[model samples]
Target: MALNRQLWIAIASVMVIAFVSSLAISFQSARAYFEEQLHLKNIDNANTLALTLSQVEKDPVLIELMIAAQFDTGHYQRLELLDPSGEPIASRTRATDAVGDVPGWFAELAELRVDPGIAQVPDGWQQYGTLYVESLSGFALEALWDTTVELFLWFFGIAAVLGLLGSMVLKSLTRPLDDVVDQAESIGNQRFIATPEPRTLEFRRVVRSMNILSARVRDMLGEERSRLEEMRQRLQRDALTGVGNRGRFDDVLGALLADDDPNRQHGLFLVRLVDLAEINRQLGHQKTDALIKELATRLGTVAGEHRDSFSDDHLARLNGSDFALILTDLLDAKPLAERLTEAMQELAARHAEATSLQLALSAGRFGPGDERSSILIRLDDALARAEHRETTCLEWATQGEDVDRLHGSDEWRAILHDAIEQQRIHAAHFATRRIDGRLIHREAMLRLEDARQTLTAGQFLPWARRLGLLPQLDLAVAESELERLARTPDPDGEPIALNLSIDTLLDESTRGRLLGLLASHTARAAMVSIELAERAAIDHPAAFREFCAVAVPLGYRVGIEKAGLAVTEIDVLHELGLSYLKLDRSLTTDLAASESNRSYLRGITGMAHAIGLTVIADGVRSAEELTQLGELGVDGASGPGVPE
Candidate 1:
């Protein structure tokens, strides 16, 4: 059925046909030549014997003796003598009709027939009697059979050698076709990668055409990502400093506070340049802007050093003189605030335009159940007190609860370890649906419960990550999801999408274990989807690629959550056989107001759908946003706004 095999069969058939035809022609020619030679020998020998008899005396008894002597001396089947009147005769005949050493089948096929040689003899004065002489043909037939067999063997050997040579040549010629087939299959899988062109003229043309198509798609993705990034910067970024604006900061903080987990808390630093007006008056606005940009960059770098995952939105310029730094993890704020002060002083010393810079830093913690207005007022009050000190300084805002009461690192680690080992880890399912209200899947978020309280992933994931137990937690979540699927085996049941941490995917041993579990429950695994954060997937592409390569084949739909955050990695998306891409909640917030973001999202959905990936929006808070998402060709959306 394969093309290569078909070609081999055709070549073999041609060789067989040629061998048969050549053998038949050669056998026929050998048989004719042997028959002619035998005929001539029989004629010559018969005439010679009859002439000898004519030279001798004619006698019945003597003639009989002559015939018997001739038959005994020569290779003959029969010899005869007869009178001219055909009344009396003397004859010599071979008693046994056996073909010596030749096979019966070959003898039947040869079937040699040569006319007997005949001659006349006369008496002394008159014709005493007419004599008849004939010669045998068994030896002649045996010679012809040997020649035919030798010719057949020669033809067979030549055909076998030609067939071997033809097979090798056919393989070489069709090697390029194999590559073409592989390339087509990759395209079918939606991984648009180009392959090298082959030397065969026809195959080279086809491959080059496919490569062009792949390149076009890649270029389109790159162009769309560039456009989306440009629009996002315009909407969410500060023009002068390139960090997030006040609006972007509010969005991130609001989302963080809106989480259902009361234990979710992070440190926030509000830094104000106390002398921005004075600096702009004394130095040019350009110098002031440069100074602000420099300070923002240094602040972002410090935040990056403290946190493993860094983003531009983490450091934002709230206004002309105020900048905010959000650290997602709870740490000793004084030490980090000291580092910021040192960085600011270093910047002041290096700036040639400014004589000196004064700043007031307000540090505090913010979480759920806290009012944004009240927290800002407290931090502003703290900033006023720091400004009253008359020197560059930092002050901590008053908190309703003591930070020291929180669990220590070892305690949290033990708690997480016990929860996983004791099988206390579970998941809460959130349904995502299509525009037509059909259920797509139920997204699973990890939850940990104890005797008195329940903890969401937003509450405990940071600690789990800090304690390096995310791999265990992720495995626990996958196991829970698998068991849930096994229990609910209805064909119409919505699949559960399990979120896998980048930590587990990056570790070889953990990744192997996860894949092994999926392999064991292959049928049930089909009812579960695996997903990773967009930023993590972008940061570590090799691990994401390897994860997809393994998980996708195990009947798991692999995808990226919080997608559209990193637009620059769009080119890598087509290379990864992803099942879906979930747009971040930030992209959909107030979608009706921002035409730029709508266009950006439209481009994302277009490109994603072009490659056969389903696009979903996360945290849609209003019917208006959901309707707009549907109008933009988004496949599905999930949030408080989407009705169950």
Candidate 2:
């Protein structure tokens, strides 16, 4: 039963018990009082009669007549005259017929007591005869009936009233608890904090304790989450830009696109800087890094708008002059691209003075049916098609028969996952950036060639990440690149910069594997510096540093690609003892035009060189910018600008 019902029941039971007790006591008292009154009346009448009989002495007939008259007028039994020896001398019957309205059973049940009465004979002790009488008890029985009925009515009426009042009292006490429970459930991933101002002192105290406990739990959970998130962010983010890394993009984006909900669409874009080499030469690495940070903050604001529509759309630095975005679960591509271009236009307007702030955004859209390789090829194509010094541009990819298609939604992901584990991944083409005749770093793009045309890294990246298969992909692709390097030795003794993910590095096992892969060639160790997106390193600064502590000593150096304009705190990257920094594409596309861009590139390069780090420029498509990079004293330059 409900608490209120149970309380009311208990109260009613007690009241019933009390009423029963009261009724028993009441019944007895009423009987005694009525009987005493009747007995006193009988005694008074008997005394009066005795006096009358004494005055009528010497006349037996008058005495008998007076006694009979009194007996007939009053409620009494018989009046009799007996001798001193207890024998009856004279008697008046008074009962004409000896019939009674009361049944024998009822009279026996009642069994009321009557008081004895006596009349003096021969006028005060003559001793001729003694008078006898009985008292009436009819009034006593009537009184008892009336009192019992009143008691019954009162007992029922009072119990009902008390029962209702008691239930209300209990309800008031428990209502606050019900409210507390509701508030607790509403909390989600968030924590609860409720301090009620109850009217009752006891409840108010309870609420206070509850509030304190809730706050404590919230704090504890938040602290734990912060610790775990720091580690995860380190693994999945870029160190310089403070955004997600390339691993998160490939793995996370692929999974998002695979979900073929008509409500959600997918878009990925790349933004490159035009003047990072100039910035590195003029402003130094510190200020160039600052510009990347400023640009990241601006773009992040636009991406944050779709936060609710997407679960985890990560934006990250892919390399210096190249920042990437994996927009998961979008409604459509056209509007998203349009909105992005608008956002970039606004960003450019804000940093109009920053020459290195010139951003060229190349966006690509793909659906569930679209092939991963084709999408990436299309993005590469879009970049190739991007106008010189363009601020914003967009393109949508279509599905073709040559691209891998699965039977069901999950079947395709399964195939890709199997391919990565078996080391089926192969490299198709490599673009290397050199300082003069020395080959320093090479950007290795993967190709899945299986009984068909070559597949680009983009095709598998999205799926691999989505299916939680990037670790496998990272291993396969890195190992393949290393194997190819072992076969094709570079004539130039320059350091080789190969693409590496902070995700794989943070994983001790993967880091160990990478170390083992590079262990054979001690001469190539300094030549092969692993490249990563800065967002990953920054997010996991501590862990990345820890991994570096182990790996850097093993003769493996780290390089950061997709380095943005600047970030909240870029000191973490410098402190980690990184070897090289690449400017993100967003800041470099129009380096020659924007003065702000010149300032930023100068700032980042100067900072990097101050820390004994080399700055490599990627996506340098024009010869004019190439000559400008040489003037800026950039350590190296990549993209189509290197006399392709």
Q: Candidate 1, which ten residues in sequence have the lowest lDDT sum?
A: 304-313
* lDDT of candidate 1 over 265-339, digit per residue (tens): 677888888878888988788878888888888888777665532222267899999999877645445567778
For each of the candidates, give the backbone clash count.
3, 91
Question: How much is 520 displaced in model 2, in angstroms?
Answer: 71
Model number with the top TM-score: 1
Candidate 2 runs further than 4 Å off: 1-37, 57-65, 82-111, 123-128, 148-193, 197-209, 256-265, 297-314, 327-358, 369-371, 385-644
TM-score of each: 0.81, 0.50
Can you give the lDDT of residue 42 in candidate 1? 73
Error of 2 at 612 (Å): 51
Candidate 2 C-alpha lDDT tens digits along 1-644 = 77777887887788779887997887667666766776776667667776666676557677667767777787776678777788876676544322245454544555567676766666555666777777656556655656666787888888888878776776787777776665454333132556565777877777667677666755654444344345444655678887766654554445444432322346677776666797567667887788788777766776766543332356777777777777654433455566777877776676566553556667765555566777777776666555363545543433331233323338647667657766667755445565573566556666665445545554445455445555666778777766666676564533345666545766778777766776665555655667776766656676667766655666777777877543324444434546777766544655665454455566566556645678777767667876777666677777766653
**Model 1, clash count?**
3
